[model samples]
Structure formats: structure tokens, C-alpha cells
Target: MPIPTSNGHASRVQIQEPRTRSPLPPSSSPIAFKEQQGRPPPAAQQTIAGKLSRNLFKGILFSQLTLISLLVIVLTIRGLILASSHHFHPKKWYPPLLASVAVSGVASLAWQCIFIYNPPRAVKATFWLTPILTCSVGILLVLIGSAVDAGIGAVFVLFAITQSLYGCWITPRLEYTDKILSLSTAFPPARTREVVSLSILVSVVYSGFLVTGIGGATSTRTNLDLLFVSVILISLAWTMQVLKNVQQVAISRARYVNFAHGEDMDAWGAFRVTVKHLIGSICIGSTLVPIIVLIRGSIRSVNLMSGSSDEVMYSGADCFSTIANKLITYGNRCGFVHVGTYDKGFVEASSDTWKKLRSTVGLEKLIDSDLTSSLCFLSAVSVGAVSSLTAGIWVLLIHKDYALEVTLYAFIIGYFVGRVALAWIQACVLAYYVAYSEDPQSMRFDGTIPNRIQRLQLLSARRDNRELEVGRDRDDTDNC
Candidate 1:
């Protein structure tokens, strides 16, 4: 029963496969019986509607509306203060703002189309091509940035190079390459158009936030102005995070409705559920991830820029912050799956999600996509690098002083767009995990994974047995 695994060790893993079946031998295929069972459980019913109908706003007053109010207040204060001055005009934001919106919308739709056509290829290409694009683009930008001295050019180059190298290093080490590749396009493709439109809507709203962001960032002068700008940027970032999470909730709901309840729920219908019932919980859920990320970035930036005498302390702080962010982000994602599935508060949903994951597949199996995650980050950074380069070049040509401002805006917008494009994969994964956890033995969830894994196990078993036979022959020779 012991089989060598990818970790180069043998373990007695009793394969839960090769289930008893009729008409054909069990040796024919690893998943012959269960693979044919594709329909949802008979137990799933319309009672889910009753569970979903309740008003489940957990923290609207303190979380979602508060971010909205803060953004408005900061924007109003900035507008009033700058009413008399011609120094920082919103008119200057027009071109880059339009550019960001257009790029974001087009890039998102295009990426969605790519996935629609071939999910496996898209996933594979993202892992392989994004790194090359990132490295190539990084080197090009580094050359241009060094020559032109454009402000955010240095940041873009560094991000590109770092993300590219990380992606290249991680891809080859991925364990379940075939499993993830097959799982990539396995979702029923009924929910494409609505999600695409929702993304477009998010991109437009994102541009609105960027407009205020563009104005505030370029207009900071006094300490008060700086405070106002920081609040505005942070609030905008939070809103952007909320929008993405909303889509995530919608995708989970859509999958649940289609598969579990045997009903149809398009992106907009699921969006309505999210906007109606889950907005407040989502707002609360979205709050910590972005805030922690902002804090982590601020810490890293401070440490890197300080050129601190005590490198040890700075290094420790940076590592600590980064680890904390990753832990929180991973927990938050699993938690949101529970939130989307049931009408529970953020904390309660997240708690239940952990219990379910631990009891079912364990945390290691669910969150072990290091290569996929790295590729996504690198792809987003690559998009940001392209945006930064294009914006920087234009700004340097026209008005070099504000080149940093425009490039930063472009990078944020481009990165957001890249994330939006990749959102469906994340949504499918979480939804699949939730569905699988609900009915582990019988759930018709991602059939491809089981088959591929069975094949790997068989191969590993054969390899291990061969090695044992060779060892026995050597021992016999030594005895003779």
C-alpha cells in the first residue's frame, strides 16, 4: 500500500478510489463509478431560498457606509480647500483617468475571453508567459527609467523583476500541476457573461475612485492635506477590495445555486443577493485584508527607504509583517466562502470555514497552490508594469513633474484589472472546495482532480515497487 509521493517519500495512503462498481472491472479506470455520478444530491432543495432570503447585514453602519462617508468627506474637504487655487486642477486628471478606465475594462474583458476559450491553456500560459513578460518588461523599463529619471519608474522595474523571479522559481516546484490544470476549465461555463459585466461595472467604479485618488495624491501639501489624501487613498483601496469580494460572493452563490439547488443564477442575480444580503458582511470581511496589506506595504517601504543601521531589526519586522499578511489573507478567503454559502456574520462564517476545511481536506491541501498564487501576483504586477511604463512615457513627454502620479494611477488600475480578470479562477476554486466539503463522499465536484490524482498514485506505487525489487536483488547479491 505504500507509495512514493512527490516529496520523495513512501507512505501507506489508502486510496479512497477504486470503489466497487458493476459491468466493468475495477482495474479499468480509477474513477469509473463515481465519475458518472454528476448530478447534485437529491437532498438539496428550494429550502435554500428561505435560508438566503433573510436580511443578513452584519456591520453596514460601522463598516461599508463608513468607508463611503470617509471617501466623500475627504474629497469634499480637498475640493473646498483647492477651490481658489489653480495649482492642482482636476482637469489634469482627465487623460490618465480615461486611459486607466479604458485599459482596465478592455484588459478585463480580454482576459475573460481567453479563459472562456481555454481555461487550462490560460492557466498554463499565465504561469509560463507572465514571468517572461514580467522579466522582459522589467528590464526594458529599468533601462528607460534609469535614462529618463521618471519617478515611479524605479518602483515599477523592481516590482516586475521581483515578481518575475518568484514566478519562475515557483512554477517548476508545483505538486498538483495536472490536477490544477484539469480543474482550471472544469467549471460549467454558464456564468460567464454576467461575471464579465459585473467586472466591467467594478472597473468603472474603480475609475471613479481613482479620479479622487488622482486629484488627492497630486495635491498633497500641508500635513492636513497629507492626512486627507491618505484617508482618501485608503478608503478608495477598501472600496476596491469590497468590490472584488462582492464578485467573489456572487460567484460562490452562482455556483451553489446552479449545482446544489439545481437552479439558475446569473452573475447579476447573484450580484443582487450580494448587494442585498451580504454587502455589510462583505464590507466587514474586506476591511482587514486591505488594511493589513497597506500596513505591510508601509512597513516594508519604511524599512527599505530608511536604510536603517540595524538591518537585523528591519529585516525581522519586514518578515513578520509579510507572514502576518499572508496568514490573514488565506484565512479571510476561506472565511468568505462560508459567508457566501450561508447567512452568517463574518467572524462566524470564517470560523465555520476553518472547521469545515480542517475536518474535510485539511488546510495543507486546500491552500497549497503556491505556484498558482505566485503566477497571479506576477501577472498583476506585469500588467501594472506595462501600465506604469506607458503612463510614465507619456507624462515625461508632456509634463515630467507629475509623471509619478500618473504612472502610479495607471499601475493601480492595471493591477486591479489583472486581479479582476483572474477572479473567476479563485471563485471556482472556493466554490468547489465548499461544495466538496458539504458532501465529500458523493459531491459531484471537480471530477478531473480525482482521476488525475489516482493516476499519479498508481505511477508512484509502481515506481516504489520497482525500487524495492532492485534493493532485494542487491541484498541477495551481497549475501551470495
Candidate 2:
């Protein structure tokens, strides 16, 4: 066999014993790059081979996201007390609310215990119960909201009803979604509370925004309070999205290293790399989703306030906007996978992810993807509904005045728990898609989900074939 000469030359040279070994190239040598990367020096005393960590953990620095998150936290807190002072009743609201949160926390902890043991069945159960939770919550809230004249309750009821309807719609086609979620359980990340801690922080940030923004809203124009409220809300919106993407990116990086390179990267290490290098990429990557949402919401608000003179025009706008938002959301899910795995910017990652999905999995995988997202979302809210029921009833019987506070706190705690549990599944599943896209052969971690996309593709093709045959038969009958 040819051997790498101790000298930095291509020509073959005789292997020598350790005592007779030649020196390696100095850092300043012309052949340093080639020599460092080339075949190892002859069997002499060579330094131990480098670890994967040396190469795998690297990226250009981007810290803007870190700054933004800090800024939002400060602003949201300031806005919270200044804007919502009137709504907060310390004497009537404090004790019951604290008790409600404690009860909800215990319930939330119990719920998470199920997830810790058998994840799939827990998720499956949650998925099935989403419709029930939504419908019940929607009906009860609508009745109580009407009785108590609570606009916020009505808003939640509307959202709950919509979710209930979607849960019903997605029920029949849930097999693949179940499989998709089940498949993601194959990856068991190390115990890392970074994501959970951030989720709680985010929940707190959201509470501040919800209270302060609602309190600050006014019919009057050109007011500093309203402007400050708008800015806080917007910042909160963007900050949450960016932080979510950050978690996904961190999870992807860890899973990608585990899958693609066979490295054992823990969540903390991956998150550190994310904070050190990929934070800015995540911020830029996640910006468009919030922007699209803001635009759609603004248009809807304008149309509603103006009494919707051109209903058809506004309807068309809604249709297009919804389509665009859904498309971008899907694209972001896939695209962020690329960003996490490769040293690419958001747009390039998105373009590449789309092309890879088209060439390999096609449109059918998107169906399964949609199913997974919908089910996860339903499962999340359903958890919140159950938590609210657990805590709110007890508080309601005694401190009837603080029903809203109890429900809100309980639901938020439960939702935060759900987010902590489910976000990893979503992030890992996307990483799986990206892994399959990058290299299909190495996905032996799970056999069932590897062929799932292919199965979907075949089913799609067969359905199309049947449709074509039916069309041809109809044409023949018409001719006869």
C-alpha cells in the first residue's frame, strides 16, 4: 500500500519507525493546508486523530436575535404594569390566582409524566381529545362570555370553534400524521430544559403583551400610549417567532450531527453553537412569517373597522393571504432544516429545501406534513383546555370574580408544558425530512417512517390514475 511520506510530498516513501520519524509541517509552511488535511504521517508517533467537535461546531457569528429577545423582555415588563394597572386587582385577584397556578402546575406535571414514559400514545390520546376539548371550551366560553359580556372570552371561543372544526376535518386522515409523530419519537434527546425554560419565559412575555396591549388599546388616534403598545405587541410577536425558530435550529443542529455525522451532540452544546453563530440566521429566517401574519391581520382589522364595503374584494384578499401564509409556514419548516444542517442563509436554504422536497418526496409528503402540524397544534390547545378545567372549577366555586384570571393562568401553564413536550417532536421530524432529503440511505434509525413519504407518493399516483380512468370512461359514455 502507498504511504503518506513524513515529508509533505506526493511521492511514495518508505515507512519508518517512531524514533526515526520526520517532523510535521509548521503552521507557516506552504504545504500546511494540504499536509494537515492529507493522509496521516507514516506510522510514527502521530497525535491522536481530531474529534468531530472540532469541525462540526462552527459558524459565523450572529447576535442580533440575542439582543432582540433581551430588549423585548424589558419592554414587555414595562408595558405590563403601566398599561394594565386598572385591570389588576391585587386584593381580589392575587391569592386565588396563585393557587390556581399551583394546581395547574401539578396537573401539568402529571401530564408531562405521561409523555416521559410513552410519547406516542400520549400524543395520540391528545390528538383524539382535541375536538372534544375545543368544542366544550368553545360552547362554554361562548355561553359565559355572552352572560358576562367578556369580549376576550368571545375571541378565545371563536378560535376554539375554528380549532374544533379543523380537528374534525383532520380526523379521518390522521393515520399518517400519527405515524409521522410516532416516528419522531425515535430520537431521544438528553434532558435539556433550555427549550422548556425559554417557553415559560415566552409564556410570561406573551402574558405581558396580552394584558398591556389590550389595556392600552384606544379609539383615539396619534397617542403615545397606543404607539408604545403597538411596538411592544409587534416586538413580542417577532421575538416569540424568532425564539421558536432558534429552538428548532438548535434541535436540528444536534440531530443533524447525530444523524449525518454519527456524533453525540447534546442539546446544550447545540444551543450554545446556535447562540454563538446561528442566532442571526434564525432571526432573519423567522422574520417573514411574522411579517406575513401582521399584514394579513392589519388588512382584516382595516376591513372590519371600515365595515367591509367591498366584501368580495376582501374575501379574495383573505383567500390569497391565507394561502400565502400557509405556504410560507410550510416552507419555513422545511427551510429551517437546511439552515440548521448547512452553512446557508435562509433564502438559499428555503429554495434548496423546496427543490429537494419536490425531487424526492413530491406534493404528497406535504399532506403528511400538514397533518402533523395540525394535530400537534390541536394537541397543544387541548392540553391547555384540560389544564384550565383542572384548576378553574375549584377557583370558580369560591372566588367567582377571578374566573378569567384562573382560566388564563391554568391554560398558559398547560400550554407551556405542551409546547415543551411537542416542539422537539416537530423540530426532530423536520430534521428527519431534511436528513432523508440530504441522504436517504443513512436513515436506518427508523424503518417505518423512511418509506412513509414513498408510500404517500404511490397512493397519490394511484388516485390520479383512477381519476384519469374515470375521465376517460365518462368521455366514452358521452360519445356513445
lDDT of 2 by residue, 360-392 (tens): 645435533455555455656766777666555
What count of clashes does model 1 give? 0
lDDT of 1: 0.55
Off by over 4 Å in 2: 1-88, 93-112, 143-175, 193-234, 290-331, 361-370, 386-417, 443-446, 469-480
Clashing pairs in 2: none
Task: Find the 10 residues in a row with the least total lDDT in model 1.
Answer: 1-10
Cα lDDT tens digits, model 1, 31-136, are 3212211311112232543234322334443464467556655765676477447376555555655566566566566666555454456556666666455444
Looking at model 1, the pairs that clash are: none
> Following a full C-alpha superposition, what root-mean-square deviation does model 2 have from the true structure?
13.6
